[model samples]
Target: MPSGRPSGRVPTAEEGKKPGARSIPPGLAPRPRAVPDYVVKYPAIRSPRQREGYKGVFQDQLAEYTELLGEVRTAQRRLRETEAAMGRLPRHATSRTRVSRGRDSAFLEKQQRCEYLKKKLTHIKARIQEYDRDARDSAVYF
Candidate 1:
């Protein structure tokens, strides 16, 4: 007993189990967190079943596709961090001539850019998916 600890030694089978319920079971591990939808949806693959590959129509759109794939995940992560930071930021300025915080304007601009990326990502993802669908429809399977 170091002081506040309930027990210094483990109870053996011969000693019998403790009466009070434990918060977590002895052998159980915590469940793994689920993968976010953005990660799953942002993969480069068109589909597992349609393995033939992309066509000419979608070839020219590869720039947009790659950009979406890279940006969506990064934007998603930045958006989460920005959201927490946004809560700590002061909403109303104390005076008309100057901001209460000297660097508040810069922080606000960074926050707006993060939000813009997040919004742009949704539209990009939708456009990419639509292009993917069109490419798949016209794909020639061997």
Candidate 2:
């Protein structure tokens, strides 16, 4: 077996600086600094809110984004529930009874609502992105 001990003689310049080799001094290795939990929890939002006019616009966009995000989540949950309910109800009948028709109509209504909410959410997200770009551009100018 090969010995694990270092042959501790410093090389002269004529035989030094081998390719892909490092020469870190003994006991001088860098230690990792510990990051605070608060910093991780509340990492800075890197938007253009530092500027004057763009701050309000960015804030408005952020607020709208939060609101729409909540609405989208609710819509998604309700859509799932509605779809489940629709699946539980009878899809076809021998005759078009009033109860069956009502159930089908309710299902169709929920499907329409789900589609509408999805489209609205997409539009809101696009607007938020546009506002973010605008804010960044304005900040660059100032």
The candidate scoring highest on TM-score is 2
Worst 10 residues of 1 by lDDT: 49-58
Per-model TM-score on C-alpha atoms: 0.28, 0.30
Candidate 1: clashing pairs of residues: none
Which stretches in model 2 have alpha-carbon errors above 4 Å? 1-50, 93-142
Give me the displacement of residue 100 in model 1, in angstroms: 4.3
lDDT by candidate, in order shown:
0.54, 0.55
Report clash pairs, candidate 2. Answer: none
State how far residue 116 of model 2 sits from its true place (Å). Answer: 15
- On residues 1-118, what C-alpha lDDT tens digit does candidate 2 reach at each position? 1597777877796478787787778689888897643334323334444233334444565566566656656666776776666667776732234334334564556555555445
TM-score of 1: 0.28
Best by lDDT: 2
Worst 10-residue lDDT window, candidate 2 = 93-102
lDDT score at residue 10, model 2, on the 0-100 scale:
75
Model 2, 113: alpha-carbon shift in Å? Answer: 15
